[model samples]
Target chain A: MSDTETLTRLSTADADGESVTLTVNGERHALRLAPWVTLLDLLRERLHLTGTKKGCDHGQCGACTVLVDGVRMNSCLQLAVMRDGCEITTVEGLAEGGRLHPVQEAFIEQDAFQCGYCTPGQICSAVGLIREGHAHTAEEIRELMSGNLCRCGAYTNIVAAIEQAMGEQAMGEQPAARGDGR
Target chain B: MNRFGYSRAGDVAGAVRERAANGAAAFIAGGTNLVDLMKENVARPERLIDVTRLPLRGIEEREGGLRLGALATNAEVAYDERVRARYPLLSSAILAGASPQLRNAATTGGNLLQRTRCYYFYDTATPCNKREPGSGCPAREGVNRIHAILGTSEHCIAVHPSDMCVAMAALDATVRVTGEGGERAIPFAEFHRLPGDTPEIDTNLGRDELVTAVDLPAESFPTHYTYLKLRDRLSYAFALVSVAVAMELDGGTIREARLALGGVAHKPWRDREAEALLRGQAPSPELFARVSDATLRDARGFGGNDFKIGLARQAIRRALSQAAAGTPQSQTDKRVQ
Candidate 1:
């Protein structure tokens, strides 16, 4: 959160390498990282923002799903250098000022996870779904959120959580809501 | 993933220039497949020219139809209002393939350039002709439940894994590209290559050429169309056998028809002779069966995927029937109907 901490986190083996400017979670970060460093690795390893889990380092699983410029994408597949000058919002940035995001609240209420490894990605994906205003039905949500896999088989409840969050966000209890009606 | 130099290009010319500078350099727009391949060591590129910054992200109205930008994300193309309205078959096919995260990151060009998802191809421990030129293909006799059943060679049997391409082949889309030699359009049918002796090459695209856009014609099979993709799972899985059918029906008789198959060949399989049989004919069970039989008459599958031949035949008939009935397969719903 401090300047020294930020610099320490942004420090890479090739610190003077590819210069990139990114705004992650409302913070402007001018970093120099290797081209091979993925955004997932940048967030987790360097920045210590481990809330974005790494289930499968490959893009097959959505555990590393994040919002880049308000669009949901697999962070593992995106190189940090490619995401230059973009606004990235990970699971750590969902809540505002000590309040849990509505999706996070809904996930807890619906008992969306057993192992809790996939909850962050599921929650972030749900937030993105609400943002996209594409999936209006439970079936659509299930289809759209198919990327985020929960190995504990908590899909039924995860969908329920997304459904609840979708309704809540529609009603505009959350500030990030687009007011897309349910 | 292996270390690779990354450079962001501003325009198509610059992207092509960067790629032409180095033969091993690959243009990366929405690195969904390329990054995955890099992780698996399947594609060890020394440098990646990021073309996402290029001004090819627009989905514009071109000549009454549409010009889908090469950089446009799969989600952007599938969810575009015009695409959903005019070309629902393309929308359905795109939605039927990848998940939301993947679709969000995968570009139109990247989708076409994506490598095969064969088991032996992905498993680097095994010998795959597609991966390694002279290593030999284990899928010819090994675990090959997902191998190709049509247009296969003794060297390789890996299928072109793209739901969108199947619909593109049916819709007659044209791939527009640019290189140092200038620009030229590749016909949809001829864009991909069948694995004859060189199993390494997937498409006819030159290493230096950069795809700028894909232009769709004004003609659309609006009323009668269906993209029926039958996969191993309900969602997020690659197709076992998929069919895209677009028809122009005049009351009861078929005026024109375009049919394409996926997960059955090295490219999206389209049989003009089989489609020719439907001209000026009424939609009937026998006619559908005849056409299906004609398409799969020469289809010979490897051991594990022999059942796919029968599945492909039934799937073709069902998709054609669905197009005739004006009931398209829903990507949201997992039901085959």
Candidate 2:
């Protein structure tokens, strides 16, 4: 069948024919991606930002958590093409000028992980949880961060780290100081 | 995921037109459920029409009511101050479901349209009447601890897996949609149909039509309402048997009541007659138990889910009593009062 026989007569592209622009960690990357290429794949494979881990690939597990436009999202569930012209921040971009982010420093101070496989997602999700300004207590932080599961059973420390960061960040810390971690 | 054509529609009209042009085309809003289904090979759409960029993200107030755009994210809806104050049931229900990340991406329309979490339906190797018409339902005889108890048919026993939809049914929201010919509003009660002979068709929504927005009526029953969701785990899990109750209490009597259940049937299960049982009645544990029993009078559960019948009865009574006492279940704390 000819291409006209199909419904894609508009400015449409075939699976691998689409081109999109995404700004990641203050770096702009114009990529020609297939419709099936997930944002997690684009970050890990093409852009070589391997910080975002892919766990269930489905939204069930939040291992591929990343900040999309200042909001935490499962990168594996989002197609890279759908995020055109959007800003993204990953775990690798969480440190600024060789200094760890507040969440990261708190994680270290709290010893928030055992195996450390889920650290990236936990930290990223904590950063977003703090930015969302909803979790004011340890219980609230644990509830909001329920998406990212730690198989190493580091939830207690993880919640402690988040509580410390939230307390410290709440003490007159400028909002602008956050997310510049990259 | 299979290779599929991709296009971003600038407007809702363009989206409806393009999707209508292709029979197998699908609209991706949050990609929270659809993307996961695609990865599992449960859904194989030939093309994806990206409606994320459509200019339909407004959350407007309509006199005493509220109009939520189809593109509004679940997180946005759950955290909206108006929704939290007036429609707290909806906020708590939405928070009771998926995690924060999934909520940030899921949309209002997509949440209503999410496929069932039936294990048989997701496993392509198994035969599912819902996935393929006339195909045998394995869940009916297999592990059905999470299957429906009220609206089960010989062909299917899958339940509609959405906590937000349960609250919407209790709120009496209306779904506004548009098609090639024109537009029309469907009452929330009539939008989702029972799976009688055709389990393949989940709702009354036409394949060619597109849901534009959802409108909630003025009577929110904000003062007396609670969304109690019981699941396998505390968070990031679907409901085992959830209840949403909204009642208007005058002193100790119930003037108006709207009750709905999730993880119990094809749609948010509700019995108008059962709800009528609560009207003009004094609130008591005995009265609430009678209402719960009457609500589940015809509820028959499979072997694996027979325990759900008793569980549903208790959940309904607890939810009703909570609503009557004006102490709604806290979504963040997850501790029963």
Candidate 3:
């Protein structure tokens, strides 16, 4: 099919309702939504994955961050139609088989949450930060993880959690199987 | 946000054709800026052409220069070894702008196309000449502390809000674009335009044209370079006044210099006259002060932004000193005072 024709079909397929199939948290969901529905809305409103908080509806805050194709992005800034065939991993996807991911465990041990509102986004952002392999020092962790802001001022504990997670990963305590590929 | 038609373009020609088909159709890449504007009602596109699938995400060394595809994410470009080692200014500037998740999603082309964060422009209820031409500019006499001081038209004073473009302007990059008329190259300085009578138009690119890639010259600034950004906070805030400086020194005398300023104009502010003053001059505080003066001599500030004129001057001096001393600001460094 021509690109325009395909797009036209995808957009007009549901004049009464738009249908989009999203592979979120290793599960596939076919949802009917408006064209203006943001990915954050689809996750929170329709799928009941409220674990991904919405601090700023704009892209300024990283509270709505989720892993698309294993790379972190602001779900609020993205449209549901834009992520048609992509794999999305939210905060709920971090723990597998009831065992917490290393980052999550570290956050709990480090007491990285005061209000616990920004914890999900911060944990997801730290996981993506480790995958990117950019943060080695405490300062680097603070700089790169500046997107997920904690209004409760839990930055020091957050940095410590990220560092602990990094050290565990470096020591080969957590296997590479914990994270899906980007 | 308003309801909009959506489509995905598989190729460059297909994308251009799709954009030409609709007068109000906008090509959405990262959607970091366009989505925000849509939600704010500043942009009311009737159709959106998704260009993320197009094959324009390559970063290659070509013709003794680096060719960065339009869809390459900001994180990819900033973390590329070649960019980090050769063009540290570009890497530092990109890192200094947005947060980690934003950098991961924001494309290089989208960074250039990002709109201003002007308070009046984003508020649909307010009177903004840029958002609605002939509406009259309330920011001219309102709270415009973050407004432009260099390129102020009577119509608008919104400053361009991209640290990456400031470095690109200093690096003498070129923007590659494709449209109905085929491909062409626009110099970095000419790509973004100052807000004159038409503050509505932000760039020189035609409506149907799409940015394909950005080309950087083969030359590299391995030693002397710094991107000094002063902001209200340490992170996740827009620049108050940012300076990108890359200098080539021959025994303490500047052999070549390229300078650009951000958050002070509608576009990345570049002054060849100021750059000319630093050429062949030894790295000294007095020379840096003279260059800063020449650069900001024509700056006329609004009521709240009168302090930026002096702040920008001090920033330029410190940035030059850091570059000359080979101490480019790092992530751990304290915020610029």
Candidate 4:
């Protein structure tokens, strides 16, 4: 596509015509965004970070969830420009080069996906949720993850993956026995 | 999503000044509700004044009670030590709202100022007096399962959608605001207006005024408090019916009571009649039923929301009972801080 065509594709024909520079998954891109151009659109259209999915487009569905400044937010309900200078980590950023993050590995091992469309957002949101320290128990996990929907009914496996990841972190921080001395 | 310009204001004064300078500028905090509306084109502010970095983000002990800053998240207010210990009802109300993640992002001021979750208000295709005056209210005749039953008008019937505000209303909370005219306080009951004539004027706030904090009063009502919410789902959704009640019990007899109804009116409703009737009466299912009747006497329902009136009554009864139980505070409740 030509530069003009690219610009036209990136621009949302809406009321508040604004421009935004977004850094997503460690890449910076500038584009003209409408007041209505959601972070979900910026990720999939402008930056081509297609890992985030659009479910309800409302905050009800967490399918478009991303970590904005290490906190999970529904990207579909967010404006791209509204997140200026904020660090956004999407599902595409979960793996470093070839190694999967432990949460992603656990999700795969626990078979935490069925259709897998909601899996990317689910995993990204889970990572964000755990970092926020909300993965305390099954009930808390269920309550925290209620925003993300898995239509395939893989909630049981998803919870297991999150718990397994939390357990690993707990084991890694055992304090190394204070009495024994370093 | 609609395209719009954005601006970041340095402080509360700067934000309010920007809104005054530009008629279409909206102060954005947390972006929990405003962003959703922007995406749906329900709200099309030309310029957004980001208020997240403003100094309005603390919960302080005031001379009378607690002063919660506008930018204080719902989670912060709910988990604050003073709020939990002195005002358990406020904590319960916040928890009864959307899930933990959403509560973390929703601010106290935003929670009070949030627009109704009426289906008509959300759907741009539908005509709503709240969205567009003279556009008409389809909720009056169409599917109205979640519409208001009390304090409604011919133009609109959508209920105020915050459980926190309901509790605040019962607590006689005051909203501190700063605008072109300077600082002033508004009682929580008077903060939100009824849909009566001008449904568009949700609050008495001037266009330039920014809510800085919510000031609660220090009152020893010797009250048992509870917030009861009825929703389609157990979590992550707005209330269909809710009640926030605080009552003083004297040997199982009601000495005084403060009752507020949610999902029932244009604003969080304080049922004065119910409050009056409950006083000097024994706390019983029968007395609750009578007070509930007094509260819903003039409740005019549309097509599908007549059921909410009864559900709201039941919720009120349950909340009152829980408060009267006088259960000792649990260990987890302390851990919330």
Fraction of the true interface contacts (Cα pairs closer than 8 Å across chains) found in each model: 0.89, 0.93, 0.89, 0.39
C-alpha displacement of A58 in model 2, angstroms? Answer: 0.8
Candidate 1, B39-139: lDDT as tens digits: 88888999999998888889999998899999999999999999999999999999999899999999999999999999888888999888999999999
TM-score of chain B taken alone, every candidate: 0.99, 0.99, 0.98, 0.93
| Candidate 1 global Cα RMSD | 3.9
lDDT value, residue A85 of candidate 2: 97
Per-residue CA lDDT of model 4 for A74-158, tens digit only, reads: 7876766667778889988878988888788778778889999899888987887788774598677877788788899999988
Error of 4 at B336 (Å): 22
For candidate 1 chain B, which ten residues in a row score worst on lDDT?
B1-10
DockQ score for candidate 1: 0.54
Report the number of the highest-lDDT candidate: 1
Top candidate on DockQ is 1
DockQ of 4: 0.31
Q: Give Cα-based local distance difference scores for all models.
A: 0.90, 0.89, 0.88, 0.78
Off by over 4 Å in 1: A1-12, A174-182
Stretches of candidate 3 exceeding 4 Å from the true structure: A1-19, A174-182, B335-337
Return the clash pairs for model 3, or none: none
Residue-wise C-alpha lDDT for candidate 4, range B31-130, written one tens digit per residue? 7888888767889888888787789999988996889999999978987878888988888788777755567678888898899888899999988898
The Cα error of candidate 2 at residue A135, in Å, is 0.4
Cα error, candidate 4, residue B125 (Å): 2.6
